[model samples]
Target: MKLISSCWIVDPSTFEDHVALLSSARALKFEQHCPLEVIILSGFNELQLDYVEELKALNVNLNDCTDITRELFLEYRHLMQDINDYEFLCFIRWIVISRFLVNEDYVHIDADLHMQINSSDFLKLFKGLTGTFGSPCLVAEHGGDWFQAYCHYFTMLINDKSGLLQLLGDTEISLIRTNIVSDQDLINSLEKNNRLPTLLSSFNLENWSVFINPLWPYITKPSSPVGFSQNGPIDLIGGKPVLFWHLQNDFVSFLGRYYLLVDLLGSLGDEDLVVKIPKLPIPYLQMDCSLANIIFRTLDGLYRHSRSGSSRDRHKTYDPLSRLSVTQRFIHSHKGREVFSERLWWENSVFLPLNDLT
Candidate 1:
């Protein structure tokens, strides 16, 4: 069995620190558990063998796939012109897995993330889900579903080898007009038709009753006694390494970015904890790409979220302890009625260790 990191880069995107950052993530992945390999699922182009070798020589692994041939490149170019990032992500993600027969439990990390904990430990985050585990329960991140995530964070545990093969097999060769979200996410209609595939179950993931804040270490059980007595879960608070550090769209998209999950490598000590949100891409594009716009956008969002009293709320987070002598699991052993709150969790600055997994 092998753990593989598969990624594709558009032809024109500059290689600022993207390669270096992902390489660090790969290194962390190896440090946590079994030694892993990086599978570069790139467009098979002619020539540039020497350049490819140069990258290999520096210890960055490579594998070639012709998924991005002349035929597909044109479609990608058209998407870029129309500014369809969502659809592009979907097409690229499914394609790589399809080309590679990833039978073993492999974790997929988006290229932009920098690892704080051993990347391999991330495998534990989504270990058992068979990908086809029915409807996954989702946390209403922005309080409600006003602006929710179409997909979960980048580091996903994909158990099924045929994850989304049926839906994506027949991609059309036409321009994606009107809305990019509709063309890419494909969820609005899937939900309407009642034909969405057997996606991962959401209830299982949210089974932890008490969040043993590694940072706080205290088990913050259900807010109310009735909830605890009624129904929840029973899980232990064992010591585990923080999973991964994600940097989304400049500002720390995940609340965990605010605090560092110090316990990344189990008992190895808190050596790789990174607190504080990553400022911005050092430089978005080398050749006059709009770096200023990206930075401004993040700042603008943070400011808006703060002013509206909706940006500052965040989910409960934890810090990793340096060592652990016992294993812990949570048990939400109660059945309670769902209640609607007048105010929603509007903040995003969660107190997560820089190392904790997203």
Candidate 2:
């Protein structure tokens, strides 16, 4: 199965886009043995040279569709002026996917998504589902109450490119005066009208969990402690392994990375593990001085103190190895790079190889 993602760099200074794409590619290629092809706009050149080199090192195929994306953007410019560029990119990506798809089917995932399961397992799951659903497009049903019945575009498997192209072409866009109509909404409309042979399956939702606004704590099972098994982070909830975690937003991504670091450190079984808080880069520290980061840092300090067995707080010391719910296989961090730059853990000396962790 072919895996695809897209990147359009709006900001040149921040490395969040690079980190998201790189992390997703690394996790899939190294852990799942799946190669990822990135359909990037021409704006990719705006990123740092080192990041471009890193993408190359991963052997991530870069398909530059600058002219096509630009032309499409121009066509929809009048109707999309009020919409955020990032949101509009979501729509643009599907157009790129349509162009890329041919005889073979493709799985299109957001750049920020991190994979835990291997390609073979994922393919097996898809085949089983398609046998029953018989749909050209299979998308995960949203887990939240707001759009529970709608299909989420974060992860999609497309078997028919022409069908998708026709659907997009026939979609209508009204002038936006206030709220923006997301591509997800459009896709849902198509599905509702029976114009698209799309299957909104809960099979993916049962395994994938999205952590977005009002970042909720991960559901933990004290009886089945989370730790590294030969299969990777063993977090079982209700006897079911988590297949994916969608970490939406900056602060959430920051926390997600912290949790990941703790899991890795805890796997070592080092009771004396002294995780010194790294000094934050000036830009990141200054830009992300939100209450969430402050609270996180404060709690981090308290947790560190507890690890030394000095805190008098009634709550048990945060045990990295024991807390995570490992049911989700795909851990996605949306809008990564704002608060906690990956440079802290990813570049650290203690960072273990992906092969070792998975």
RMSD of every prediction: 15.9, 13.6
The per-prediction tally of clashing pairs is 43, 15
TM-score of each: 0.39, 0.51
For 162-236, candidate 2 gives per-residue lDDT tens digits of: 454454454443333212246655554455455444433424545643222212213321232222222334333
1-358 per-residue lDDT for model 1 (tens digits): 3344545555513332233332343234344234334545554353256555554554444566545333454545454444454345444543444345333444444443333334354344445432322111111111212112233211111222134334334433123432323222344333333343322343233433222122222233233321111111221222222222223332222122221111222233644322222232222231244765455455444543443443343211121110100001010111110110111112122222222312
Of the candidates shown, which would achieve the greatest TM-score relative to the real structure? 2
Provide the lDDT at 315 for model 1: 19
What lDDT does the true structure give each of the candidates?
A: 0.32, 0.45
Once fitted onto the true fold, the runs of candidate 2 whose alpha carbons sit more than 4 angstroms away are 17-19, 30-33, 47-50, 128-180, 188-231, 250-358
Ten-residue stretch with the least lDDT total in model 1: 322-331
